[model samples]
Target: MKIQAKSLVDTVAERLEEAIIGGELAPGERVFEQVLAADYGISRGPLREAIRRLEGRRLLERTANKGVRVVDLSPERLEELLQVRESLEGMAARLAAGQIGDDEVGELRKLLETHQETSLEKGYYQQSGDFDFHFRIVQASGNGFLISLLTEDLYDLLRLYRYKSSTMVGRAEQALAEHHAIVDALAAHDPDAAEAAMRTHISNARTHARMALERAEAEAASTAEG
Candidate 1:
């Protein structure tokens, strides 16, 4: 019984974490224990436990007396985070290319193929596939330490911007082309090419996201005054 309770808490935490990442739970939104407990059909005990778990993950932050809110990302903060992520992920790509086996490379190619099938979808699921591709690359680097360094929260911050940029004309197709270049470099076992390809891919993604956020903010300001 105790174990099942713990499991429930974990389950709740996972779902809530995804919700936060996928933007269903926006940043700065207060988390109400009573509301979520009732919605998930769980008791407050497990829900509180779940909240604490997410808090530990850095997905949620607590205020002095104001309870918890989803962690917020300012434009500068998000850009800084992207820069750090690109450096880490670029190194991981280089290491992966140096040591990855043919089978692993083939598996990554397969992920790219799957993503290509829906590349034109230009929706949440398509973007989800893109995330999966990048995640598989990082995990395949065979570095547990590197894998631990990047977590879902960091990915979430990027994903929010990615999702918005996906709606832009030609962005999804451009992103897919970059993915193909990366996979090709990795398959050829060209560490230099692989690292360069991966770095360029992240650079382009950051550019698109920054532009999208800037445009959105500008439009919002215009609408507010008009």
Candidate 2:
């Protein structure tokens, strides 16, 4: 009975995490336990447990009287998160340049080729393709701690923010060019160049996100005054 209960809780948590990361559950949106419990046909016990797990994952937050809400992706928080990513992903790229096998390099090149083709055809970079490229590099870094930090701890939140940021005008093509530079450094097995490229890419992403947020806020203020 206990084992079954745990399984149900895990299921609920995974579903909720997907919903949040997929943008079905918008950031700062409150989660209603009763409605969710009823929708999933689960009791509040397991549902509450699932919410608690998401809290641990940093996907949800609970206040004294406000209940659980999805973590808000404000501009300030976005900058902080991107700064951390710049440092971590830069290190990952540097290590990967030294540690990646020839086959992995080939795979990365193929993926970039696909990205270029798709972007040219679709007029934007595919978000999944971008994620795949970053994920592959981090995995090839051969640093277990870095892998876990990126894949396990940060990926869900990263997906959420990436989805939001990808909407910025002209960002897709710019990001593709930056990705090409990173791939070039990796192909040459130059750790310093790889790290520099990764840092610059993430820094540019941060700036784009900030500018988008500022534009959104300005639009909102203009609407209010109008």
Candidate 3:
């Protein structure tokens, strides 16, 4: 394994993040440095750095003697995470209403259009990472403290649950409609409306997530019975 990319560490971190989110690296799966380095075609040096970064993000956990594995979040923890997200992201939308530029508002509109296409044609929800509505709104908020808390501290965990939870029956279209409501409030520069819409959207997401989890549990139970 050799490093050719300029920022090999960052590249590897991002790829690993994607793999975890995409379920290529399943939750709680043990990670082996030697195998992963060979698989990713990067040296253990940079790959180790990437793993450490993810550890900081709480995406991976290291155990004494047991070694490192992807963080496997329990249902209770995921609910707690969503509670924090609802508070912080609601504040972000409120702040963004005051601070967002006209250009950024247009960017939000265009991003919605892209999401609309994907939702309609491809039959999925929003994009992850930079193209995400939540990501853009947090950027628009222009508050470094909130930005760091949401993006650096909790972004990956949030995204993982968001992607997983969104598969609830008929949730994709509803979530897109919620996004439109949120963007409308932001575009109007109404702090109250923006915060309300964002909070509502997050609350709805939490509900859908619970429903999805319950459905999965029921299906698993039925399979076991059979």
Candidate 4:
């Protein structure tokens, strides 16, 4: 079987994206192309191609002389992203409420139930599970453009922040409860309720992100001063 160059590049890009979103590659960390190429046992060509793909996804940025680095998530940027999410996902939920099937609702219910059990057992919600719940709702909305915007364009960046937000004290439990409310609205086929619930959930997440960022900055400042 012949492996296509594009496929290989995309595979490499996916691995790098997972590393970035999983926090293995810290935000603002430089990408040492040669080192990564050597580590992956691939040539620099595919590595560069992978970097270009990640850059297109906004997961990486190239500075004038500093080369490529992971995109940093700032509080202001996080707020902007979540504001867009609230608007987009709120609409998605509203549409989903009207269009989602009974089976889809059942799937969502099972997901929520699993999340509840896992959160209780692990003492926190898994970021991947949280994303799965929202992703399922967006998929149920039956809007191709909306799906592309949320899943294709913004999903990786969303995961990065969601991973960070999941670490903020009490956020996982609160988000679990919010997920239940959103699912309740969806199950009842209440578009207005679904939209409001989604908006509130994203809004709360944005607030938590802002507070977490502020605390991080303060700690950094104190450390620098000391």
| lDDT by residue (tens digit), candidate 2, 166-197 | 66888888888888899889989999999999
* Rank by lDDT (best first): 3, 4, 2, 1
Off by over 4 Å in 2: 1-15, 38-46, 114-131, 219-226
What lDDT score is found at residue 11 in candidate 2?
Answer: 84
Q: How many clashes show up per model?
A: 0, 0, 0, 0
Please report, as a residue range, the 10-residue window in candidate 3 with the lowest summed lDDT.
119-128
Best by lDDT: 3
Which regions in candidate 3 have their CA more than 4 angstroms from the true location?
Answer: 1-6, 119-129, 213-226
Q: Tens digit of lDDT per residue, candidate 1, span 78-146?
A: 689789878988988988888888888788778767767766675423344334777778876778888
Superposed Cα deviation of residue 14, candidate 1 (Å): 2.6
lDDT of 2: 0.82
lDDT of predicted model 4: 0.84
What would the TM-scores of all predictions be? 0.82, 0.80, 0.86, 0.86
What would the per-residue lDDT of candidate 3 be over residues 21-62, giving only the tens digit for each residue? 776897788999999899878779999999999999999999
The alpha-carbon deviation from the true structure for residue 69 of candidate 1, after best TM-score superposition, in angstroms, is 0.6
**Runs of candidate 1 exceeding 4 Å displacement:** 1-6, 119-131, 151-169, 215-226
TM for candidate 1 is: 0.82
